[model samples]
Target: MNDAVHSIAAKSAAPLPKSAGVTGRTNDPARTMAEILKVATHEFADKGLAGARIDEIAAATRTSKRMIYYYFGSKEGLYIAVLEESYRRVRSIESELNLENLPPEEALRTLVGFTFDHHNGNQDYVRLVMSENMLRGQYIAQSKSIQALNVPAIRSIRDLYDRGVVEGVFRPGVDPIDIHANISALTFFNVSNQYTFSQIFKHQMQDPQVLAQRRANVIDVLVRYLRA
Candidate 1:
């Protein structure tokens, strides 16, 4: 995404051979990649794609730069990989929610609460999302699997809403995508605008009490809107 890192891909001479070094290189390649991603995620989220350095990530991961490239293909490739992993992680956890077993209203509330907790606890996800938007979503656009990764989120809403309507618990004719947009908007704003909003409004949005109230409000707002 950054012009400076654009050519880093072409500079990759070749794959790196495994070596015994603290470069985070080890006999286990998967573990090495995971270590790299863990460090790189913070680096990229903190500094963004343009400012993030492979050398810094390499140092942090104790893995060679060549090793990083060998796994991801390029800096951009690694960045995309990071984005994909972030989305995949949240979605993967969401799928295990097993909302189908709960009543529609409780399921919706649980989902909203979980979404809020996730956005609050995983500020990295929100920051990465904010960083991506600042780039006008160009890097994320390069990612082919991102869209597919998010499909289940909307599908989950659709399934719940359909069941609710059939049971006469939720109102009919609500678009699942619209419901999803509302849910995300409500939860996402808490983390994305925390600092600026706090400074501007003198409200400590991150305070546990405040967050608890906001969390309740988010769940109530959606439940009220969806219920028959």
Candidate 2:
């Protein structure tokens, strides 16, 4: 080719500035992903998988659809990612509670209370869980690492229960998984059923006094059940 043609082609073919690219590259990819996940969490929780829109999430995060897809591959991929992050966040906080340092009964109570507070305060997490259940957990089942995130929770309970058994405070033969399940059920109900239960029963579940009483009642119920 002639010099003029070669020069023109080179100019035309040269890479665009990173700023000019469609990828929407960020200096802080981790922060960008976190932001996207944060917005997507609400989107999925509020709309579920079938109803959530990537464009809306991107708009909310000041990101592009391409960037979200670049990071998470697809809408379902992002949903799965949000689920992982939700579970990871809860499990991360649960791990940091340091329940092992407390006595078994106290540990159980603390764990239950924390779960209650977490579910109550972070209703989005509960909503995401409920949304997933509505799909029979098909998306959560796609997550390879989510189950791993929850293992430490059960292990923590197991350690505390073993200590309680040794100290003769908690009865023996109870499965740690069952204890975890019971605690989860008791705490989960407070958030999951609050609106419906409150409406049906004609009571204010969000009342501070009522909440305090319910929290104490749940803790008492579990503690009494495990006492030797």
Candidate 3:
């Protein structure tokens, strides 16, 4: 009986009904699960764990909470599932970039570009993750599998730093962990507090051209700071 478990159990008990006028029989449990997850992800992102309603999720997916529980076990479980899948998709995309093959400078540029694009394009994902972190990652750290997904991104960045140091392209003393934190902080800040940032700066950061220019500026700043 912790608050998290209690929340999950409450959601599990009250399931919603399916939508009307949608009569289709399909043996695509996988597709159904994916659809549910896609809707759930947005709900969780918009509301955070505490505020997200299972009924809302059900309505969005046109399914019942029982079905969600049947597939994912509980709301906590569903939240973790959404996060793991999201991380997997992002990691898969990062893996394909193959920064290891590029020269140090080019690899850094590509990596930064990808990070910028990811945060900008997937603002919901960014908000979801920031909310999780703000909660001290209590839910996310519970899953070992989810934690393991970060390894590839970490290793790739480390490799880039190593190569850069060897080639005299970057300052020799930068720690990979520190570098990663800086990059995340820079990219996440603009999106995470877009409203506040807009209020303070008196402009919309959501504009596509503005975001694109910011992305390039971030890459330039990082490159200049790291380069020897």
Candidate 4:
């Protein structure tokens, strides 16, 4: 297998964490960590790893720079943690999709639509990813855990494709990774380039009606691609 496949296979071997949804811990330190991650996520997404300051994040939260360093070790460490937590939260929300009960086509539609909605609503996630890509994924490379966190997302697509094939509703030999890339590309561009796109087209991309139309379009595209 190639590197991507091998990485996904290895990551898939491990089960997701039980508390992948949220921290699930209500204690002080847990709360503090959660708080730090929250502020840090926005800070990093807004200013990036190099541009974002630890003191800024600390001042924004009810925490100190000392506590920030104490919790995350360093600015880079905090940035990595934010990256991991951001992906974890998105994947966690995806895990709650409960796609098993839906028909194959409907499951694919739901997945695509959910992704569109997520990317549209969570601009921070998009910005963080855009910034990371801008830096050629330097911080992402430092976090091996990110690969594991993302594996479930690909596995879900693979499982859905397998089921769809078995049900004779989907074309055979469609690679799950390809499907993911397609879906991500479609949805990600809607958010990552919305500002520039809006300016170029002079369109109100954020309007609710426009979003609804785009959401439907995304679902239709993915469903068509997956359908047999």
TM-score of candidate 4 versus the correct structure, residues matched by position: 0.86
Instruction: Mark the regions of model 3 whose C-alpha exceeds 4 Å error after superposition.
Output: 1-23
User: Could you estimate the TM-score for every candidate?
Assistant: 0.90, 0.89, 0.87, 0.86
lDDT of 3 by residue, 1-228 (tens): 224433543444443335322235353456667888899889889999889888888877776776777667788888887787788888889899989899999999999889888988888889889878879988787765666788888899899989999989998988888888888888887788889989999888989888888888999989998999
Q: Candidate 4's residue-wise lDDT over 128-206, tens digit each?
A: 9988899898878878689999999998999888999999999998889999999999999888888899999998789
Give candidate 2's whole-model lDDT.
0.84
lDDT of candidate 2 at residue 28, scale 0 to 100: 60
Backbone clashes for every candidate come to 3, 0, 0, 0
Looking at model 4, which ten-residue stretch has the lowest summed lDDT?
Answer: 1-10
Looking at candidate 3, the ten consecutive residues that score lowest on lDDT are 14-23
Candidate 3 to truth, TM: 0.87
lDDT of 3: 0.80
**Model 2 per-residue lDDT tens digits across residues 126-226:** 99999999999898777777898899998999999999999999999999999999998998998889999999999888899999999999999999999
The regions of model 1 sitting more than 4 angstroms off are: 1-25
- Backbone clash pairs for candidate 2 read none
Off by over 4 Å in 4: 1-27
What is the TM-score of candidate 2?
Answer: 0.89
C-alpha lDDT values of all predictions: 0.86, 0.84, 0.80, 0.81
